[model samples]
Target: MQKTNAQLRAQARGALAGQWGTNVLIIFLSVLLGGIISGIFGGMTNFETGSTQASILEFLVDNLLLFAFTYATYFVALYVVRGGRAEAGQIFVIFNKKYYVPMMIINFLNSIAGYIVGIIVFLPLAAVIGGGVYLSLVISNGQNFGAIADNAFSGVAIALLILLLMLVFLVAVSIVTGVFQFAAWTKMDFPNVKVGNSLRYGWSLLKGRVGRYIMLQLSFIGWYLLGILAFGVGVLWAIAYANVSVAAFYDEARKEIGDPV
Candidate 1:
């Protein structure tokens, strides 16, 4: 049977009962390394000014580090959940050549998927804004200020409505595409799995359970808000809690699907 979100969360809390120190250290190390990388490349890339090479290099390094840290967290979570002691050095596991190439491939595919989704979700809003701009220009050419003012009001209203609709589409897209959210986890579970097969396995694991996964995530909102209230200190704990909770979820999910957890 699939575990309830509550059960998974309780399991996470239990697994983390005496392991908070290691988990926090893992989170801290990843954040620290990421900050250092961003700092080094920050001055070299300016998106608006079109610094293409620097921007691409920064993007690549940032994503590689992201995948490495993310999978490392998963590695720790798996160990903790399985009743083993998690070590801080687990963070270096994903840097191995065996794991690095698959991480890059997954990262590339994710970037393409995000770009396509962004274009699709915001296409209407872009069209509405562009058409409004063109119409305003045409109206202003007539030297009719009153007509331009009226057109401006209607255009603003139309643009706002389209923006609202686009936000809804964005949320919908996130939920729909969330099935692939566990691709990295699949790779973590079966290290020898190819990138394509890992994605497929991840999809199969969550094909009908996306809503459950989403709800599990939503359950953390209150904890996250509380963390924010504590001047960001509590967020580290929340992050640790949430990461392990997700690992527990994956463990149970695989078992429920008759795969080795």
Candidate 2:
């Protein structure tokens, strides 16, 4: 039977009960590492004179660091989900090399997909904004407002169409992302699985359950808001809890799919 959101959360809380300190420490280290990386890049950008080569190198280094950190975090969650002892060193499992390239490839493809969706969603809006600016310039140059009134109405119609397109684009992207949400976890848990196979497996597991997954995430919005209300300190705990819950969900999903856990 599929687990309910409350049951999944309870399982997550149980898994985290005695490991809270370790998980909190992991979160702190992750944050510190990210801050240090940002500081290094920021210092380099600020102190070194900008050049095309320097900018290219900076961008490459930034992306590499981001990918490493992201994979490390994923490894940590995978460890927790697999019932391994959560330690700070678990995050370094990405350095195992066997998983590094595959993870990077998966992330790169996901990034490309996101960019395509973003362009499709925003291109019309961009055109509308550009046209609006041009119209404003014409008006400022003393073009007749009466003559442009029809054009303004047409622009309004185009803007409405863009809004509808953006809404549809967002929905489509959400569904796609939800379907593939567990691809990295699949790769981590089942080392033999390739990127494409892992994505397909994740989609198969999530079949007919994307709405439930979305609702599970939405259930935490209140805690997230409360974290923000607490001047961001609560956010650390919120993130830890949310990650554990997601890990718990992954565990349940694997079981439901009879994936030989």
Candidate 3:
């Protein structure tokens, strides 16, 4: 039988019972490294006044640094799940030559896919709404609606149609990508597995359990809000708890699906 979110969370708590110090250290180092990366390249946010090349460079650097730290955290979570001793050094595991490029490629593709999906879903809706508002305003001013429709409304209608097409595309992409959401952990847990194969495995494992995964994440919202109430200091503990719980879920999920971890 599949474990409940409560059961998974309880298992995480048990795993973390004597490991607070190590987990905190891991969080600290991960934050420190992320801050340093952002501090170094964050200046590129002013690319509005800079060249196109500068903007592109900034974008690449930002995503690369973000992926590095994110993949590192996943590595730490996997280590904890596998019952390895947690150490601050685990946050740097992404720097190891063997897995760095593959992990980065996986993360980059995931991000690109999400952005494309977002654009496809929302861009057309935005254009239609914008044009409708403009037409409404013109009509309110007692302008010639027929002339306006001929001159401007046609363009707006075409744009809306394009947007509708994009929205359908986005829906299709989301369904496919949602199925492979757990591929990253699969890659970490089974290092020898190819990326495509890992993603296929993840899709199969999570095939009918997307709602449970989402609810598990939602269960932490209260703790996250409580962390915010505590002047952000509590967020560190929240992050630790959340990451460990997710790791615990992944372990249970693998077993439930008859996949040996």
The lDDT for every candidate, in the order shown, is 0.74, 0.72, 0.72
lDDT by residue for model 3 over 1-261, one digit each (tens)? 778999888877777778867886778777887778766676646555468966676668756766667677667766776676788777878877776877777777777777777776677667765677587667668477655545654676677777677757755564555444467777776788888887788777766876777677778889889988999877877878888888787777788786533
Candidate 2, residues 155-196, lDDT tens digits: the string is 667778877987778666765664455787888778887789
User: lDDT tens digits, residues 134-198, model 1?
Assistant: 67868578576566556654766777877787766656555534444467777766787777887
TM-score of each: 0.82, 0.78, 0.77
Predicted structure 1, TM vs. truth: 0.82
Task: Single out the weakest 10-residue window by summed lDDT for candidate 2.
Answer: 144-153
In model 2, which runs have C-alpha deviations exceeding 4 angstroms? 45-59, 127-181
| Most accurate candidate by lDDT | 1
- How are the candidates ranked when ordered by lDDT, highest leading? 1, 2, 3
Q: Give the lDDT of residue 217 in candidate 1.
A: 75
Worst 10 residues of 1 by lDDT: 172-181
Better of 1 and 2 by lDDT: 1
What are the root-mean-square deviations of the candidates from the true structure over C-alphas? 3.5, 4.5, 6.0
* TM-score, predicted candidate 2 vs. hidden true structure: 0.78
